[model samples]
Each structure stands twice: as C-alpha cells, then as structure tokens.
Target: MNYIQKGLLFRLPENNKDFSITTFLDGLKDSLSATLTHFHPLAARLVTLKQQKPPSLTVFLNPENSPGARFIHSVVNLTVADILTPTDVPSVVHESFFDLNKAVNYDGHELPLLSIKVTELIDGIFVGCSMNHMVADGTSFWHFFNSWSEMFKSRSFNISRPPILDRWILAGSDQIITLPFTHENQYINRPDHPMLRERIFHFSSESLSKLKTKANSECNTTKISTLQSLSALVWRCVTRARRIPADGNTSCSLSVSNRSRISPPISENYLGNMVQRLKATTTAGELLDHGVGWAALQLHELVVSHNDKAIKKLMDVWVKGSLLVNTSVHFDRNGVHIGSSPRFDMYGNEFGLGKALAVLSGYANKFDGKVMSYPGREGGGSIDLEVCLLPENMAAFEADEEFMSIVNV
Candidate 1:
C-alpha cells in the first residue's frame, strides 16, 4: 500500500433524537474494536525493511502493539440542513474533521492506522473516519466501515465477508535496475500549498442523461458510458476555466479498479490497493473547440485501451521505476483526476440508525483538479461530485456556463 489518507463522513439523521451521545460513542467504540478483530492489520504498525531489496515494509501485529483506532467526540451547533447547503458544506466539514497534520506520515508504531471522529450536530451525527492509505484503498476502507456498521447493527462478531491480507499477490518479479525507482522519489517530498479549496456539485440524473445523449450523438455511437461522458464534460470545462495555453496539452487521468482486469479476477474481497491510473491527453484548444462527444471519445478510447497487455505493461513500468509518480500525476500540470464508481452504495451505511444523508471526504486541498463522484443519497438516479481546486480556478469553474447548465448548484 502507498502512503495515502482517505476520509469518509457519514451523516446519520436526527430521527434518533432519543439516543444519548455517550451511549452512541460507547457503542461505536465497542463495535469498532469488534470489527478490528477481523481486520486486525489496521490496528497494527508497519515495520520498515531498510536492509531489504526493493525497499519494502510489512505490517507487524501483536497484542501489545495495537494502538487502537483513535476516537474523538465533538459537537457542532449547525443543523444537517446547514451542513448540506451546498455552498457551505465543503469548507465547514474540512475544518471539523480529523487532524490533517497527523495523517501524512507513519512514525513506525505510534499513529493509529484508523481513526474515527464523531461530530454531534443538533439534527444529526457526522461519523468521520480517517484511514491510512498505506493500509488500504477506498474499497478496503469501505469494507472496514461496512463491517463495523454490520457489527453495530447486528451486534455480532461474524462479518459477511473477510478480507484477504496477502500483499504479495502481485510481487515476485526479477530484480530491476534502480533508475526507474528514482522517478517517483522526486515528487515524494513535494511541499503543500494552502490556497486550494474543496466544493461539491450535484448533477441530477436528467443532466447525466443529457450529457450522455450529447456525447453519444457527437460520437455517432451509443456505447459511451455515463462516466466517460461526465469525465469529458468536466475535463473540458475545468481546462477551459483554468485558461491554459490553447496549444498546451491538457490531460484527464482516471483511477480504475484493476480487480477484474487481471487474467483471473481478483476477488472483490481481496484487500489493499488494486487500482491503476490511466490517462488521456489532448490539446487545450482542441478540447475547447470540440463538443462533449469528442471529449467523451478521447476518454472512451482511454478506457478501452487498458486490456490485460496494457496492465502488464504498466506493471513492468512500475517495477522499473519509470512510471510517473502516482501522487504527483493527478494533482500537477494540466492533469484532472476523475474517479469513483456510482455503484459503491455509500448511502447504505445504516448503522442501526436510518441511512446516511450524505457522504464526504476529509478537508484538504492537497490536489487541485481532483473530482470524486458518488451516487446521490436520495435514491434518485442522480450523482454528487466532490471537487477540489485552487480558489481562483474553483471560482471560474463554478461560473462555467456549460458546467452550470448541467449541474444543479
């Protein structure tokens, strides 16, 4: 697992007004411990292998070594309606979540890999989880959350599915030259700038259908997917809003799950990071002049191009250390990252209360031009997008005519 931090906020409605805060917190802590018994790596520490070849680390587990997941209780005077007001949601939640400073690095054995902060609002409870990306990816992180929720709901030690902890499933290749390893090293210590901001945009199902229809019509084919259509539309809008040089190359890269792409499918229950980043590049001028269909076609081509051979080629590049640094690629240059599958079922986190009203990530503008789309909580065929951008670019992007036409504030 790479060094990454993923945050998820689950909004439990105020219908549970009778539930006491102390009882809620106690129940969550107990359920989390029970859940960790099954997913124990999260409670353990990483042991660095400084003398080993390929430079790796392994999770060291023991009864005494567990720095149990951190739990914090907070009270917010705002109502759930205020938190979901669209304009105020992003900055407000970002300021209220877990400690961003502690999330960056692992100090061998101190930092808990998983931490939960529950913010009690006048009308709801915000369950925020900060997970170390080094331990799991979004899929695995959610698996832990769902498992915890199951234990909370059923009060049972048995989980529906167990995660496979074999990190070496894809390891074991011949030694490679050290040169390729150096490419990712350059961007490892990159500095963080604080001028960036995060915001969410909603596109109703009707808007998504319109976008797909326009994209498909332009491409003279009906095969364009909703993701490709939306990615193309957003890529062009953000690129134009940024006002990059007309002839300069603008790129859109997607983080795709590689679970089923391998020769033999990896189980959805197979834990850890099983995603690969692939990209499509086009000149800014061409993108600006083209319709949604042209943009969709570029993305469509990028998706179809990633077969087994391409994945193997990517693995070869990664091992040789020539693959662009994953952290820097999505945030730097003229690149825009678009990810998240609508099928993730984020709205289903019931936890004995009613389903969540909304889901959000932790507050940091670590990356500009990054976007994550999720299914709407209301069960309409709608989509919710979480976007991070520089303050100026975000202002321009919010005012973008084409983008505004499709999104519902």
Candidate 2:
C-alpha cells in the first residue's frame, strides 16, 4: 500500500475579526474525529499475521491500543500568493504533508493510516492529508476528504454519502491470501530518482471540448471522452519532449476505476482500492505521428474492452498471485503513467474557510512521467494536469508549441 498524499489551499476570508486559529483547528480536529467514526479503517492499523501458515495482512482495529490519527498544526510564514502564483509548484508545499513522503502503505501497520497536517499560512490555510493506499484509492481518498469537510461545515455527524465499508472480494477467492512479503522492511526499498520538475497545467473547459471534438472527428468516433482526449494530448507532447528514438517503445498507463466495470457494479462510495492500471504501448515514433485523436481512440478502446469478464479474470489472477502493489517510483523514461481523475471534486472540498484555491500532491509515486489529474478550481469541465518530468524534459514540454496552444497559464 502506497500513501496517497494531497493538500488543499484556501485563503481566509478578509475583513473577518472573528477568526481564531485555535478555534478553527479545534473544529477541524473534532469533525475529523466524528468523520473517523464512520470511516473506521482510517483510524485503524494494518497488521501482518505472521502466525498463520503463510504470512497474511489484515486491517486491525484495536480500540484499546490503536492511536486514532496523527494531527499536526504548524504555522508557516508563507502566504497564499506564494503557493498559487508560482508557475512551478514550490518545494515548501511538500512540507505541508506529514513525514510520510517516502513511506509505503504497509508502513500503516506502525504509522497512522491517515495523517493530516494543517499548515497555517500568513493569509491562508493549507490542509494536507496522507492516507494509506491500502485503505483507499483516489475515489475513496476524496470521498473521505469531502466527508470531513461536510462534517466540519455542518457541525454534525451526518454526511451526504455515507461510506460503504464492506470490502469487495471475488466470490471464490480465499478470505486471507498469503502476502508476498513477511516483514515491512521488505517493502521499504527506495531508489534514487532523477531530478524532476512538477507543473500544474490548466486546460479550460473550452480547450478540453475542442480537443475532444478534434479527437473524435479524427478517429471518426464519438466515444472518445474529454479525459481521454487530454491524456492523449499529454502523452503525445511528453513523448515528443522526451526526445525518444523513433523505434523506442513507449507506454501510457491510465488508472481505471472498477466501480462500474464489474457485474452488479459496486457502489461509487465503496471505501477501498478498486482501481486498476491499464497500459497501452506503442513505439514513440508511432505515437507522435498518429495525432491526438488516434492516441485518444487507442485509450478509449482500451477502456471500452475492460468489461465485467475482463475484471473478473484479472481479479482471479491477482488472488492466485497475491502480489502486493509496489508503490516505488520506478518508471521508464519513455513511459507515462496517469493517475487520479479530473472527475474528482477537488475544488468542492470546503472546510468552512471557503473553497480550495488549489490542490497539490505530495512526493509519492512521482517519477519522470507521472501525471495526476484534478478538476479545475473554477469547475465546469476544465481539467488540471499535475505533470512531473525530468527538468530538461519539463523545459521542452513547456515550450512545445502544440501543447502550449491549449494550456491556459
């Protein structure tokens, strides 16, 4: 399990003499406690049952021993403008999150499954959350964030969409499959990553619509979606920026949600990891020459073919192997991995201070080609792509004429 780290920044309302940091934090902590009552797993610990014939991992909720969640409140001299006005995300933003920057999800056995840090800026507040990927996926992560915000705003225990805590498993699969690793250290390997730069490229609703229309027209199919169109655009531009050899193989991986792909589809509120990474590979030359529409069609087709049967088959194979997901930042320089979805209401997570000014990600699962997508702050159908690349590649990517034409600075 890898930790999914993200932060939301909000500027404090002006001309308000009734603002007290102590009161705000007290409210946030109290609401978090109430919210955790419903999301029990976040407050629980994951333990390895080595006593079993083969070591297995299980979510352990010990009322007596479990330390609920770690909450830290810190004051920073930075302002909202320091974070929002930068063309490149500042390194200080990483300090907003807890000290689990390199921690894998398995560390939740001893670490807090959920760690929140409320960094008080000079004129704003930054709420950072780090959740164990083992406990949830992107969907569940945002669900918890939204629920916490709702609880804080309403000052009540009632949440609009209560989480469905039931864990999903294949019918014939063993209840506790053997884990591939026995000790936590077996999962603590961290390789040195190349120096990379991260930039959030904003694509407005109109730009996205134009891209989608162009892609669909080029592929002669209306099935290509806005997200796919955006992914295709990034893929092509990044490939070109990397300057890969003509015959070099490059791949694009999209994180696909399994909530609706299975039979008797699981609820959207399912509070666990129900996402699978599907990759479409091609030669770098082919990808760049094919145009955005062709690349979008390839992604669209990949998503369309992953139906209930395919999901079941994949689940069956996974159960037999019981391979734990590696959260390390290992990637081919020529490959692109897209995570998160623009459909997530990142900007709607209001914790009474107001809507978030921007959303930022922590230093986990970030490599040369990592991409995290979020809905634009202004909402509508706009999308924000948090693209990570090598410094040289980033420079080239930002300068690409075709890519910059659609990007809204």
Q: lDDT tens digits, residues 49-84, model 2?
A: 564555644444454556788899988898999987
Task: Give the lDDT of residue 405 in candidate 2.
Answer: 91
Number of the top lDDT candidate? 2
lDDT of 1 at 3: 33
Off by over 4 Å in 1: 1-17, 52-64, 86-90, 100-102, 105-109, 171-191, 322-330
Which model scores highest in TM-score? 2
TM-score for each candidate, following the candidate numbering: 0.88, 0.95
| Candidate 2 lDDT for residue 393 | 95
Which tens-of-lDDT digit does each residue in 157-218 have in candidate 1?
88898878765343466542233232333334443545576777888888899999989998
By summed lDDT, the worst window of 10 consecutive residues in model 2 runs over 56-65
Give the C-alpha lDDT of model 1: 0.73
Question: For each candidate, what is the lDDT?
Answer: 0.73, 0.85
